[model samples]
Target: MNQKQEIQEGLWDEEAAQTYDSNEGVFAPEVLRLTVDRLAALAGPGKALEFAIGTGRIGIPLAQRGVPVSGIEFSRPMVARLREKVDEARIPVVVGDMSEATAGEEGSYALVYLVFNTISNLLTQAEQVACFRNAARHLKPGGRFVIELWVPELRQLAPGLQAVAYQTTDEYFGIDRFDVVSQHVTSYHFHFGAGKEARLFRSPHRYIWPAELDLMAQLAGLELESRHSDWDGGEFTADSSSHVTVYRLPE
Candidate 1:
């Protein structure tokens, strides 16, 4: 299989899926609330879709707010967790890969969202651009597509300096070794516990600037509506830690 498929399959592996939420708490309720609020304000109680809605981190809460919500997820274990959450709260979800999800069933959504740097999972330009097309197809005219991703500038290291990076709270550590010759960064993560183990997840993402993302949206027949540096609607600037970008479907 190709690298992208391997990455995708590995993510859905039962063991990995079970521990995924704990590994990534950046999308906890507080962060998700901010995302839902912004989209709700813009879309005004219309239908919504959450791509890669792993464990319903964002989808369940949005559904509780009385918005009709549907989600597409690839991992069966992740979807099982989402199903449990949905059963507890009466939400609906679909099991499928976000990149290939057709625009049927629920018809179109006023707002469709993907968060927490999940877009990078594609690991290729073709897949990423196809994601944009799929999102557009699933959106109604004048709808909005929102995405939350890291700025990618945070990985920059100073000359002649090296440091260790932590992925989780005392759970995983990585040695971030830089290769100046190749202009690439590689991190080797060690999972700490009884019988220490190591796993390597690496990718070369072309950290596109906000302007560049806007251009991508334009190419997909979407327009930028707003851009923020954080979940709290802070103005985007060079020093921003993350980006919350909102794009609109043509009327």
Candidate 2:
């Protein structure tokens, strides 16, 4: 894993951070809302931790639902934005590498969550495994660790299909280019009008299968409790677009 590339690609800078939330609403808000609803059912009143809690997209709403939430984020600008939505005194936001973040004053939580394919930000197998281990360390006995990510198989492109484009808005556009041989995915974003600019970001993710994730959890002393295809609890199948995996530490 190229640690430098991972950090540079995943962590948006101050100028880009300013418009991230607005551009993110194209898909993030609705997807995260669904995640919150699902977590609310499982978390109840228990304390929760959000890994890579970018701009409080999921953490803020979860807190609003009455869950005490803390977060670990690598990007300073993103955490800064999160603080604007919720007070730091109320929601503790720790700025550090997610894979190495220890349970500090917030203590262990009943639920530790990583969403929106954020696991891909780790970029290396060792880092990803370390993230699992760290998550286990931050969980109370029998606590749950939840992850929401797009099934990697979705990136498979047909012959002659080099780029996939999604229109986010009249001015803003999202373009994803596939590099199957290199096992790399690059997303080029274009913003028009006042916030007009073009930015290129690349993330290298090992698209592990569901069974592989289960194995990783087992290796970390966590048990795979549930695997759903979507946030709504649909059955996971070959054709599922997303995987919502839940793992639990032994009591």
Candidate 3:
């Protein structure tokens, strides 16, 4: 793949797409329930658009809740996996980059959401800002844009260390190598099986602080509405590991 394609799809190829949901840790029923619940409530009675809606993990359930959901995804294989669950007629998806792609009619959606730390996948500040603008372009005047991202745990790293272990188990391991100067992170995940070889997958990302993200929202004509530690609206605090933030376009 070329540089552009690499940036767009990253490591989400056919094999990754096929096995994406196999990680039951992320696909747990209770976890998705919270996500879909919050998204459905934010969507209200209007249409919703999801950026990088891989495998329709949330989109399928949101649509099942009677919300009209659309998506923008760059990986054809991921979309193909999504199609296995729901037809295109139910959840229309535009195959393109979330940073600049136009999905549905401009300003037609009541909600545009990017979840699961997917914004970091953009790999650049400019692309991340453009993603905000793209989400704004798809929203109605009062529409909301929501993002679920992990707070960088640089505090966990000892001085002079560039890597942090995010997960460690007998069956799997995950770590992030951070470049503080460039605000970039490369996540490496290793899956192990008994009597089988270990598998590795790594992807690059550009991490953004909440304050920086708010500035990007401002640049896109969106204002910070609410930020919580989770979908249940827990208070965000210094010790929080992840956040779900909401931004709104003025009416």
What's the number of clashes in each of the models? 0, 0, 0
Candidate 1 lands at a TM-score of 0.81
Question: Per-prediction TM-score, please?
Answer: 0.81, 0.83, 0.97
Rank candidates by TM-score, best first. 3, 2, 1
Q: Is candidate 1 or candidate 2 better by lDDT?
A: 2
User: Per-residue lDDT tens digits of candidate 3, residues 49-135?
Assistant: 999999998999899999999999999999999999999899999999999999889999999999999999988899999999999
Model 2 misplaced regions, further than 4 Å: 1-6, 24-32, 105-107, 159-175, 178-182, 191-204
Please tell me which model should have the higher TM-score, number 1 or number 3: 3
* Candidate 2 per-residue lDDT over residues 133-192, each given as its tens digit: 889888888789999877654445667786777448777677667666654555666666
Give the Å shift of residue 45 in candidate 2: 2.6
Candidate 3 stretches greater than 4 Å from native: 7-10
- What lDDT does the true structure give each of the candidates? 0.71, 0.77, 0.94
Scored by lDDT, model 1 comes in at 0.71
**Model 2 root-mean-square deviation:** 3.4
**Native-referenced Cα lDDT, model 2:** 0.77
Top-scoring candidate (TM-score): 3
lDDT of 1 by residue, 229-248 (tens): 88789999888878999999
